[model samples]
Target chain A: MVDAGVNMALFAVVAVGYLALTIALGIYGYRKTLRNEDFMVGGRKINPVILALSYGATFLSTAAIIGFGGVSGQLGMGTIWLVALNILVGLIIAFIVFGKRTRRIGKRLNALTFPDFLGRAFNSPFIQVFSAAIILMGMPIYSAAVLLGGVNFVVASLDIDRNVALFGLAIIVTLYVTYGGIIAVMYNDALQGGIMFLGMLILLAVTYIELGGVVEAHQALTNLSPQVPQPLSDAGMRGWTAFPAFGSPLWYTFVTTFLLGVGIGALAQPQLAVRYMTAESGRSLNRALMVGGIFILVVVGTAYTVGPLSNVYFFNTYGETSMQYVGQNADMIIPVFVNEIFGGSLFGELFIVLFLLTLLCAAMSTLSSLLHTMGASAGYDIWRHVRANRSGSHTAEEVLHGHDKDLVRSMRAARIGTMVMIVVTVIVTYYMPANIIARSTAVFMGLTAAALLPAYTHVLFAKEPDTRAAKWSIVAGTVTWLFWGLFIQANNANQIGLRDALFPAATWPGVPYSVIDPLVIGLPVSTVVLLAFFLYGRRKGGL
Target chain B: MLGIDDPWIWTGHLFAIGLTLFCLIYGWLKFNDDGEDDING
Candidate 1:
């Protein structure tokens, strides 16, 4: 129905311009870099405004935009509840509860990375090394998921070859991040966040106009019968005015997949944890909270709201269910909606450009942070021990100082690690058999919740968490998630089996249905382990 | 004119209202910082 040619040309020009701007920013950031601190933590002097925007940019990515939005389109407006949670749990509680303490402790210890902080906190090099290893192993899947989003959007919007789009996006992000490091990534994230905010507003306005008014839209939806689209009808696809039926499978997926996966998980993210360390003071972190919260509200709130409304448009025009149009890939729904809504208009072109910029910004910012953490963990934590042991130097000061290098090598190592991660991610993406965004995010966050949440919670609340207990708690949590994820969940016949039920629509025959997600199973296990370890340590005078 | 039967539009309004309310709550919490400054250091 829309003119595809005009849309393609518009999107192409915008994409090219965005790519040029990002490269320029990367080069500019590269020239300004001075030392290890600057390369890794931006010299711990990032302004509150930029820090706030960059945090928001990194937090809400293609995962929030396309993936969650697609789920929202199916789940109705209740998805907005998750958006509210993102601001409250992800942003507010994060800034007030965790950010204040993390910044103070990180500054006290002069720790520039997540692993560095943990290593210093417990005075154990092993914790740092293990934490880094976990991030290196788990984070690539998330990165791959983001990369897939970029490729999918570009291919869909511009009608380009998927392979070309994938390669082009990956190369652009890698080059900028490798060159500029965190500084480039942060500044670009601010710009990308601004674009995302504006683009979503325009898209929302246009969508409203297309649907006539709010009242008419609701009545139209309500009038439709469940038999019209049986899955949607059952999935709580009432007139968009009503919430989904209580405890519907769609409702469960909406809550677990979008809400809990992102909302509660944001608190445990290592990438965001490092941001708390970037600010000059707790006050700076406080200032960032407001800016960050508003940005997330606009960006994430709009995506989730607009995603479901798209179903209405799709169903009406094509006489097909929105899910049918979405096919197996839930990530494609938003792009399809964009093309449907603005395919030929100038707004459409701008939307595509901004959207691609959003993806690039999200990928680069998150990747750069993850790489910096990986490098710090590897260089300062693991490699330091290896080098010290080999040279027979066991002194604590020497062990710490041996790994300390000039900023250039550290930066280069981070970039190299990033490249390695990218290759692995690309391979995973190419061979990925399921919904990369939802599944990968769920896995990563669930792992974090299981492994780090208990320790993190104790660190925040308890005056003195027994060191023995803390160490064992981390081990217990990490292993529990890994056991459920790899052994129990992975090997289950229902999910990821020969026929391949990716999400396990039903519980495994023998496994308790309560053990649905690793987070559900692992959280309680980690808590019990931590408590048991703590009590035993107290009895033994080991606290 | 399309009658008041289109659910997506109403949902959009609901979203707008809900988000606005959320923003207000967030603003209040962020701005009204009670004097509980326990420095971890």
Candidate 2:
């Protein structure tokens, strides 16, 4: 229920204040954004702290906290391994191994976007356009889901009209993104990131305090293993406190789908990768690494830790698992816990509204960045390239240095592109079923990994990047993952329905290759193809 | 170790802390080093 403490007026004052601050920042970004470079790459000199926070905010959308947090609530704290991966791979390897090189080369190539980076690296227009096309095609489903996540939360918490929240949220975020571009996105993301960090830290402290300290709470949770649901136990989950049984079905899933899929897939994300370009130099990103890592840990680690422990709280209070209280909806676990944590008192009431702001920050931060990426894919990558090729304009220097008249046209096109993509995302949100988009994130991640990662990594590291091999490798990965997701990966195939539409006898995925993530397959397929070409090229002295 | 028995789960927790420190120290160490390149200016 909407808290009695949180009336419309209180929320109104808070929301208005928050929006005012956000718009003030946007205007600041607008004033600072003089050239196209400012709009696209925050003039390639954004503060390290802002860049790091922006990257974290963009990476961990509202769906991640609520969705994955709920999963940990249901499945257990085993998912916290993703936090390790987020730091080890997502931040450390990403910033040190990949971020520095991507920034250096991106500057050298005068690339403005992820697709542009890849394209200029290979000197392949097809690579740039096709990569952008993949983003445009794949990202909308995820963005729509983010929009839905925010809208649904607003409807439930504030008791506002869903349509109003959806449109209101979209229009506000889209305005800043279109006008100020990445400068605004990064600056606003820093504020959102701070809010998220504060929210998570509060929840963590309150949770531990309520549970009588960390060890006691965990012990309480560990003692409740006997309350495991029959279906989950039978499926190889031992308990909430322990790992799923070795080599069990649950083990396969936790390892393949969430662990490797999202853990590695994070490395290839276009929105996150673009942040590497906004920093001034390797040293700036090096500085960003510490802030980025801690931010990720505080937010993601708190969710995973508090999630499983919630079982103890609920069981102690109501003799029910976290699942039982939420009627088996994993997404509600975190929200319900938050509402129940600080219930009834005046301070609790105010904190409830503050937590709601965290949700708003999470949603808008992610959505704005997604909007920015989609816009760049459309305007700067696809449209600009096509137009420039035909009209013989946008020389790399012109676009990079940002002094030419044509650059203004290009920037205008990007603004138009941001508006168009935001509308597309909102339309998708309006039409697509929530259930479908909610489950589509992993599939979307796998798709990006499959189609882009191998080629992207090759261009970054390879001394003589073979454009033909890179092209074919991308095609091979895209085709392989598409075929897999449609006909092999159980969840996606079932959603797409083509596999069973034709065959009609394929059972749900389990115990075999169907259970493997598409990225696991797609990345290898692309890598092997590239490797073969690499060997052949070396033999022939062509690459 | 902290009331959870499974070494696996606790190891993940420890590793998360370890990696965060790794990033913090690395960044701190590298914050002042501009390296041999990007120095012509």
lDDT of 1 by residue, A1-543 (tens): 232323555656777887688777766655666444545455345665666676677777776787677766655566676767777777667877888787777777777677667777766666666777777777777777777776767767777777787778767666755665544655777777777777888888887778776555544554543523566665555544355555665555555545676667778888888877775556555656667667876787778767766766777888654556767466777877887787656766676667666766676676666656665655555666665677685654455433445334544555566666667777766766534576677777777777777777776576666656767877888887776665455322334354244444544433233224666677788889889987887777853
lDDT of 2 at A57: 77
Query: How close is every model to the real structure, measured as TM-score?
Result: 0.83, 0.88
Docking class of 1: incorrect
Model 1 root-mean-square deviation: 5.1
lDDT tens readout by residue for model 2, A80-160 = 898999899888888787777777777787778898888878887788888999899888888887777676666556656
lDDT of 1 at A452: 77
RMSD of each: 5.1, 4.1
lDDT of each: 0.66, 0.78
Roughly what TM-score does model 1 have, to 2 decimal places?
0.83
